[model samples]
Target: MKAIVTPGPRPVTDPSALLDIDAPEPVLGPRDLLVEIRAVGLNPIDFKVRRIREPGETAPDILGYDAAGVVTAVGPEVILFKAGDEVFHAGQINRPGSNAERQAVDERIVGPKPRTLNFAQAAALPLTSLTAWELLFDRMRADPDEEETLLVVGGAGGVGSALIQIARAKTRLRIVATASRPETREWCLDLGAHAVIDHSGPLDEALTAAGERAPKYIASLTQTPRHFEALVRAVAPQGVIGMIDDLPPGPFDSLKSKSVGLALESMFTRSGQGTPDMIRQHEILAEVAALVDAGRIRTTLTEVLGPMSAATLREGHRRLESGTTIGKLALTGF
Candidate 1:
């Protein structure tokens, strides 16, 4: 199999940060599916992991998470899917990922690809969709009938794009998204945000100027530390804030004054820890696919950079690091 592997932790600017190499076929587990990958999606986690995590001495570390593919084979205990089933998934963080020509993923976390979308489109959904879905529904426990406001920061990014659409389709919360640039703001509105505010300024003022109230739920999708204080001030009393980004220890006591609740959402936690409810990811993806097929949701894929190669992936990482991309970036074929 041809796989793109990071030799060690290095910046994306480093020419050797990622390399294209031939690797052996992946071995399967009792509840795994061997997928022949057709396309892959890039996320901030790819570059973050590249900069911090070192590859194991015995095997290379594959860096992709979101992928769409066909099942080539299934493990003995696998019942969710069979050979030739078209599927998509965000493979576990602890496993070899979808940067390769083929990958072994747990069937409990995989879902049928949306029939309305192609491989590249389906690949762009898994990781971001799971993150958004879990953050809004599972972690925050948003009520479908509640009319309270939900503010989303970094509204044009991968997870933000999905968050806006899913919230609009599944809940009644007034969606307020933050985007600094005109194009990004338009993108958020197009995705079903009730209002869009600039994140470059103080978020509380932005929300006020946009005619939105103190949000009952705040999703700080990026640069949490920089926005932490403003978020603490902007949320409603006893409101909840959900975050997925890694943040340094800060003045959490600030939130105490408002009696605000904090929730951390990590899409990898279930599969990473082999949690009892790991199958929830599969159910979430299944619902997302249904939404897509029913025209209630759409893929966030913005551009296809090219085939899966080290140079292409490095360029994708560089673009993500630039922090200006409107939606998800994807690559098709090996």
Candidate 2:
């Protein structure tokens, strides 16, 4: 299999940061599907893993999560899919990932690809969509009938883009998103945010200036540490804040006074821990696909940086690390 692999932790500038190699095929498990990867999406997790996780000495580390592909074969215990089924998923974080021409992914987490989208577009949805859906509906338990305000931080990024659209499609919340740049602000509004504020300013003040009430729900998609105090001040009393980033300890004390609830959402949790409800991801993706087909939600793909290769993936990582990406980046073909 032709694949892209990381040697170990290295800056993207180093020539050895990512390597193109002909790797051995992945071994399939009982519930696994052997997929022929057609398109792969890039997220911050891709770069973060490449930088931090050391590869095993025996096998290369393949770093990718979002992928759309066709099942070439299925393990004996796999009941959800068979040969020739088109699928999309953010595979388990603990496994070798989708950066290769072929990958082995558990069938329980895979969903049928949206028929209305191309492989590149479908690939962009899985990871971001799952993260946003789980954070808003599963973790926060937001009410669809409530007209309360929901604020989204970093609204131009991949997860934020999906979050805004899904919220608009499924809930009645007054969506307010934070975006500093003109382009990013417009992007959020285009995706259905009722208001856009600049995150460069104090969040509490930004909400005030934008005429938005203290948000009953806040999805802190990035830089949770930097925005911790402001978010604490900005949230409505007894409201909930859902987070996906890694935060340093000790911020819990501040939320106590306001009676604010904190919920941490990690889309990989179920698969990583072998949870009983791991199949929920498959259901979520199926619902998302239906929404996509109904034109209620759309793919957040911003760019397709040529085919899958070490050089292309390196450039993708460089752009994501720049912290200015306005949506998702994808690469199709091998």
Candidate 3:
């Protein structure tokens, strides 16, 4: 199998940050689906893992999570899919990833690919969709029927794109997203955000100027620490804040005064801990696929780099690291 891997955990600008090489076929487990990967989505996790070396890690670590492909073989214990089933999944973080021509993923975490989308489109969804779903429904415990306001920070990126659409499609939340640039702001609105605020500006001032009320929920997707104080001020008392970023050193003790709740949403938690609810990812992806097929939502894939290769993957990482991509980036075929 052809694969792209980092020679070591180095910078994306490093010549050997990603290299193409032939790798042995992934070994399948009892519940695994051996997929012939047709498309792969690039995420920040891929780049982060590439640039950070752990103490006991080896070279050429495969680094991808989102993939859309066809099952070429199924493990002996698999029941949900067959050899010819089309599937999409964000594979486990603990195993070899989806950066190759073939990958072995647990069937319990995979979903049927959206029939309305092609390989690249479907590939762009699983990871971001799972993250947004978990953040909104599980972490924040949002009421789907309640008319609440959701403030989504960093609203032009992949996960933000998914979050806006899902909130609009599945809940009554008045979606207000943060995007500094005009293009990004427009992109968020197009994806179903009711309003766009500039994260680069003062959130309180922006919300007040826009006639937006204090948000009942905040999805702090990026720079959470930088905007933590602002969010604390802008969110309604007793509001919920779910973040996916690493916070800077400090106590979030301010959340105490308002009795505000905090939660962290890491999509990998289930697989990372071998939790019993790991199959919930499959359920979320399936729901997302149904939404896509019914035209209630659309794919967030805005760019497709060429076929999977070291150069293309590196360039994708460069764009993501620049923190300027509007939506998802995918690569189709070998």
Candidate 4:
């Protein structure tokens, strides 16, 4: 099988950060399914791992999470799918990933692919969708009917697009997304954000002048430290703040006064921790697939790299690092 594997930990500029290699086809095991991967979505974490290869780990690490593919074979215990079943999933992070022509993924976390979407389009949804779903529903404990104002920082990115749509679908929360440019603002609004605020200046000031009330549920997707102060001001007392960004070392001074509940989302935690509800990923993803088939939610793929290769993957990562991509960057067909 042909694969793009990271040779070693190095700067992303180094050619070895991602290298094309030919390896033996992976063998499937019990409780696993062999998927012929068709499309893969690139995330920032892929580049982060490429640049910071863990010590004592071997070279040629496989580093992808979001994939849409067809099941070519199934293990003995796999009753959910058969050969030639189309599937899409963000499989367990600790295992060998979906960057190769074939991957063996646990059946517990895999979901049926949305029939309405193509491979690349379907590939763009899993990782971000899971993160947004967990952040909104699990961490914040949001109720479907209780009216609340919601804020999603960095609304133009992959997870933000999913966050906007899922919040609208699953709850009555009125969502306001922060985007600095006209294109991004338009994109957010198109994805179901009730209002868009420019993140260039004070977010609080923008909300105040726009007559938007402080949000009770805030999803901070980026620059957590830089936005913490404004979030404290714009977030209502006894509100909820769910962030996926790394908490920088700084004075958490405002947290003391705001009485806001803080929570973090790491979608990998369930699989990483081997929790009892590990199969819930398959459940949520299957529900989301139904939503996609019903046309209740749309794919967030703004850019499609036609095929998988070293150059295309690099461009995807570079564009994501530029922080201007309106949605996900998806690469299809090996």
Candidate 5:
């Protein structure tokens, strides 16, 4: 098998940040599926991990999360899928990732790929979809019948895009997203956001101008600490806010005054700890696939860099670090 790996955490600008090399076939566990990867998706976590060395780590680490592929074999305990079954998953953080020709993934966290999409498109959904779904329904506990509002910050990114479509299709929350540019604002509206506001300006005033109320729930997709105060002012009393980004130095005591509840949505939590509810990810991805096939939601993939190679992946990393991409980036074929 061929794999891309980093010798250790290094700056993305470093010439040897990532390299392609031959590796052994992955070994499987009782509940594992050995997948022949057809495509892989890139996320901020890829670059973040590259920039910071993990403590006590002595070997090169394979770094990827989202992947879509065909099952080549299954472990003895696997029942949900078999050889030749098409699947997609965000593999566990503790295990070697999917940036390879083959990977061993727990079947409990894998789901059937959307029938309407290609491998690149399917690969783009898993990580972001799980993050958005868990943040909205699991962490915030949104009600489908409630006529509340959801305010999404950094609305043009992958997770933000997924968050908007899911909230629109599955809940009655009036969706409001923040985008700084005209094209990004239009993209959010086209994806089912009821209103699009500019995060570069005052969020509260933008919400008011859009004829929306203080949101009952806020999904801060990025720059959580930078927008903390504004989020506190823009949320209704007793509201809940969820974030999936790194929070900089700041005090959250203001949330206490408003009875605001805060939560962090880390998609890797279930697989990282081998939780009892780990199967929930499978259910979530299965539901997302149905939504895609039904035309309720679509893939966020915007760029497909050629084949899976170290050079192409490095360029993809540069694009992500530039912070100008509108949606997800993927690479197809090994």
Candidate 6:
């Protein structure tokens, strides 16, 4: 099959950061489903993995995490889906990704595509949705009936967009999202955020100005280290705070006063560490798919660059790094 592969680690500016070349199509394991990809979404992982995975290490590496496609065939042990099924998935980070004409995915981590969404739109959701879903339910332990509120930092990105909608529809939590620009603020509101505050100032003041009595749960998506002190103040006593990014400096002194619990939300942890709930990704995506099909959740796709190629993939990487994009960016078809 024709696909894009990373021959070796290279700078994004390097012509060889990604290469469009012919590679052997992947064969599926008994627990896997081979999908003919129609649309693929770009995530931060696409760029981060470039320097981490070396070429000619057992097999060449491909980079893309979220995909929407059709099931062309399923392995012998597969039963949940069959040929011609429409699927979408935020695939595992430990394997070859969906940046090609065909991808082999574990059925356990794949989900049914929202009936209302096209391939591109569906492609934009999985990774972010998975992260947001796990962050709210598994980490924060938010209750649907509780009136506690959640304050999200960096609210216009992919996971932030998904987080706002889920918190709004699934829980009574008054959701307030922090965005620095007028467009982003409007985007967050449109995505179901009850209030949108500027992330540029002191978070405590920002939340207060947004009519928040006190945010009892907070999800910090970016700049977690810099916002650590502010997050401690903005959250209520005994509140919970979750972060998804890499390590940042922290004494967590502020949390000490409130008896707060801090958790890190890494979507790939289950797969990376071989956790007992390794199959939970499949379960979560299935439910998320049902919610999307029922119109409770919508696709976060905002940019469709059309088709896949090294040049196009590079541009998608460029747009993500530029940090001006709202929601998600997808490339459709081969």
Model 6: per-residue Cα lDDT at residue 83: 94
Summarize candidate 1's per-residue lDDT along 215-248 as a digit string, tens digits.
9999999988888888888999999989999673
Which has the greatest lDDT?
2
lDDT of 6 by residue, 168-275 (tens): 878999898999999999999998998888988899887787677788899999888778888888889999999898656766676788999898898888876878
lDDT of 3 by residue, 37-110 (tens): 99999899888887884523633377799999999998899988999989999997778788899999998789
lDDT winner between 1 and 4, please give it. Answer: 1
CA lDDT of every candidate: 0.93, 0.94, 0.90, 0.87, 0.91, 0.86
User: What RMSD, rounded to one decimal, does every model reach?
Assistant: 1.1, 1.1, 1.3, 1.5, 1.3, 1.4
Question: Per-prediction TM-score, please?
Answer: 0.98, 0.98, 0.97, 0.96, 0.97, 0.96
> In model 1, what is the error at residue 52, expressed in angstroms?
1.3
Tens-digit lDDT string for candidate 5 (233-333): 88999999899998746677888888999978999999999999999999999999999999999999988999999899999889999999998999996
Sequence-dependent TM-score of model 2: 0.98
Q: Which of the two, 2 or 3, has more TM-score?
A: 2
Give the 10-residue window scoring lowest on summed lDDT in candidate 1: 52-61
Q: Candidate 2 on 62-115: residue-level lDDT in tens?
A: 889999999999999998998999999999888888999999999989999999
lDDT of 3: 0.90
| Candidate 2 lDDT (Cα, 0 to 1) | 0.94
Candidate 5 has a TM-score of 0.97
- Evaluation by lDDT, superior candidate among 2 and 5: 2
Off by over 4 Å in 4: 55-60, 250-253
TM-score, cand. 6 vs. native: 0.96
